[model samples]
Target chain A: DAGVTQSPTHLIKTRGQQVTLRCSPKSGHDTVSWYQQALGQGPQFIFQYYEEEERQRGNFPDRFSGHQFPNYSSELNVNALLLGDSALYLCASSSTGGGDEKLFFGSGTQLSVL
Target chain B: LAKTTQPISMDSYEGQEVNITCSHNNIATNDYITWYQQFPSQGPRFIIQGYKTKVTNEVASLFIPADRKSSTLSLPRVSLSDTAVYYCLVAPGNRKLIWGLGTSLAVNP
Candidate 1:
């Protein structure tokens, strides 16, 4: 029973550069969501993916996008990154069938934009 | 999405019980209260959740009033390992969760 897993534990990039982070949801889970957390702050929702389509998005700009594969794995892509984009990118997974919707999260990818 | 308000920080000694309350005045009828705890470099972990009344797990207990406007997370017997930021979220089933600053709990020896 593997829990959610994310790749590229840490990344460094410059302004205007792009970065891609990956996530594999927990077993038996279908929905995947991404969040961004700055130092000493709660996570901010980036978007959610279900059935290979983005279902919900937060206040993030268009520079942030994501993809969900058939296997329920996900990828978060940020283009034209700014210095402010430096933060911890978290991946959370949940099962849509269950009414409770308790999420399981991965350790997250730390992105540093210079 | 209803906004949640919790204490910015709390301090307590080990072997004492700690209770952190969260207020969500605009909570909807279908909304449920969920709590999470996070360490310095790790993702948030689910502690407990409840719709109304009380829900208790091995880690903590969640108490939701009948009005559903506020809830309290009770952690029994504090320990230094329990020091972390606790988040309270309110959302309907299957809806995106909205997060606030969360309450930072510091357990002292």
Candidate 2:
């Protein structure tokens, strides 16, 4: 089975612009979550989507939002990007069944806000 | 969400086993401990997870004591390729995971 996959492995955006990153979850998974990893730091939770609705969210601002399509694919959008928004945007997928939520991650999209 | 704390860096020889411990003093009874390894420019990969006692898998082993306040990830027979950042996370089932700055392990030859 193909693992999680993300689109536009690398992206460049200028301040005050908007950018969207896409993610195709692993086969047989339904829940998708997004994370932001800054240089030399651990990933910061952004939000999680389940059943086409946002179920959980972190401390991110309103400028960061996400959507989960019917096919279980997801898109993360960042509006009014700031220079500090430059980081690796990671997409992780997990199953809500079996009571154990182990995440399968995709090679993240590197976002650079100039 | 229970916060996790791990060492900043660790070093070991190629043939030696490596054990990295994580502390979560405020862990909840329903929370489970999970570990992930990440290489530069790549997303983190699942290593092993456990609720109590021990859980062993092909890649590594996870040990959790009865108190469940702490856990250890053991990688056997380390090699240079094992050099990466190891993250320790604690979260309940179906809940969002909380991540801390992980342990950077460097396996030397």
Candidate 3:
């Protein structure tokens, strides 16, 4: 079975521009979460989507938003991108059954903001 | 949410066993300790997780004491490919989590 996959392994955008990244959840998974990792830092939570609704979000600005499709795929959108928005965006998927289920992450999308 | 603390870096030779410990002094009663391994420019991979006691998997082992305030990730006979950043995080009471800075392991020849 294929694992979590993300699109456009790398992307480049300029300040005030917008970018959209996509993610396909692992087979048999329903929950999708997004994270942002800067150079030399750990991944930080962005938001989580379940049943086509946003569940939780981190401290990210309103410029960051996301949506989960009926098939459990997800899209992360960042508007008015700033220089600091450049980072690796990771998509993770997990099931909610095993209360302690671990998240499976995709290779990540490297976003470069100029 | 429980806050985790791990070392900044560690160094060991190949064929040696490496143990990275994490401290979460305020761990909640229902929190579980989980570890993830990440390589440069790649997303993290789950290593092992535990609530209490020792849980061993094919790749690694997680040791959580009864107090549940700290845990250790032990990699036996580590190889060069094992060089990566290891993160320890607490699956909080609300099921939300925040990853710590993580420990960087450098396996030498």
Report the number of the highest-DockQ candidate. Answer: 2
B1-109: candidate 1 lDDT, tens digit per residue? 8889999999999999999999999998878889999999999999998999999989998998889999999999999999999999988854567788899999999
Candidate 2: lDDT of A52? 94
Which digits, one per residue and each the tens of the lDDT, describe model 2 over residues B8-97? 999999999999999999998878888999999999999988899999999899999889999999999999999999999988864567
- Candidate 3 per-residue lDDT over residues A34-114, each given as its tens digit: 999999998999999989999999999999999999999999999999999999999999986665878999999999998
**TM-score (chain B only), all candidates:** 0.96, 0.96, 0.94
Model 1, span A1-114: residue lDDT tens:
989999999999999999999999999999999999999888999999999999999999999999999999999999999999999999999998745799999999999998
Instruction: Give the C-alpha lDDT of model 3.
Output: 0.91
Candidate 1: residue pairs that collide: none
TM-score of every model versus the real structure: 0.98, 0.98, 0.98
DockQ of 3: 0.57
Candidate 1: deviation at residue B64, Å?
A: 1.3
Poorest 10 consecutive residues by lDDT, candidate 1 chain A: A94-103
Cα lDDT of model 3 by residue, B64-98, tens digit: 88898889999999999999999998974223468
